[model samples]
Target: MARVAYTTPEGRARRDQLVRAAMQAFAQRGYHGVTMDTIAAEVGVTRQGLLHHFPSKVDLLVAVLERRDEDDSELLSTLRAREDTPLAEILRAVLRHNAQRPGLAALFTILSAESVDPEHPAHDWFADRYRRGRILVAEWIAAEQARGRITSAATPQRLATSVLALLDGLQLQQQLEDEPLDIDGVLAELLALLR
Candidate 1:
């Protein structure tokens, strides 16, 4: 039977620690490169110990993604609450925030590519996330157009798709290349084009 330590506060903390370690390992090494042993060694635990919290590598990855979603949701809510900030500026702030989180950025880059295979563990999750993201961005763009902040020459859906593509490409490039990204400047130029 699996150990029940994860039910207690200490156990939950330990589990969270394992998730953090796994995220770092997975970020540094692609999914195929890291194993249960690598993750357990990160936290000074045996493979069996890690298994007590996450029975399989897939489970660990899912847990890490879920934690990331929770964090991102909270951050997005806080950012959205800045009523004085325009959506464009809010998006630029998000990009700046992403640049500061290299580990998470790398994780997203690696996982997104891996999940393109329909058989991959996170394929559906990534697909759903992208679909929802595109929808939300499209809605935002349409609203901006209605307010006359954005030009109506292009469809909102197309603009949203382009914006998301730029964001993803920028994130990947920022990680793959050691060069610093001028996200704010790039975003400003894009927003200008939209206007």
Candidate 2:
């Protein structure tokens, strides 16, 4: 008999379900702390069933990361496509969106910190992610500079690196503290410095 493909809506939903459950588990436990069995149980699926979608725990982590990135990319492309949208405003919007998804923020923070070990499955992936993220943000900053919306005093490369660092730091703080973060005010201050 021919093998059944898990490409239908049902299959995709199941896969998303597994990814969401895995994100929650990974956020709470970190990559090394969670197991394939735990993720499967969270999703109410057998280990074999979960494996059918994600062959390994590493694959699941990658999926969660990729899903988060895709969502951000889509949101940026869709909502902030206007040339009039300042990069600072875009950054603020992204911060707001992230605040609404604290679980994802936690997952990113925990995995990124733990993935520093060369032997970790997500080490290379996280490295590439940071590299690409910096480049993309630098390009955006350069564009804004060209448009004369941002100050030209700083190089785009430096500005982009700082922006990424600030974002990561903010996420870490939000995750570590129970008090609500003044994301908008903090982002406004950063934007002011950039301007």
Best candidate per TM-score, number? Answer: 1
After the best TM-score superposition of candidate 2, give how far the Cα of residue 41 lies from its true spot, in angstroms.
Answer: 2.2
Clashes of each: 0, 0
Worst 10 residues of 1 by lDDT: 1-10
* Pairs that collide, model 2: none
Q: Ten residues in a row with the worst lDDT in model 2?
A: 1-10
Instruction: Estimate, for each residue in 84-175, the C-alpha lDDT of model 1 and write its tens digit.
Output: 55558868877877778878988888888988999888899999998988897888788778778899897988888888898998777777
What TM-score would each prediction reach against the true structure?
Answer: 0.92, 0.86
Instruction: Kindly report which residue pairs in candidate 1 clash with one another.
Output: none
- Give lDDT per model, in order: 0.83, 0.83
Tens digit per residue, CA lDDT, model 2, 1-195: 122367689998998898888889888999999999988888889989987888887788778878877987887686556767788887877787888888888888888889999998889888998899899888888888988878999798888999999999987887778887886788888787767
Off by over 4 Å in 2: 1-4, 7-9
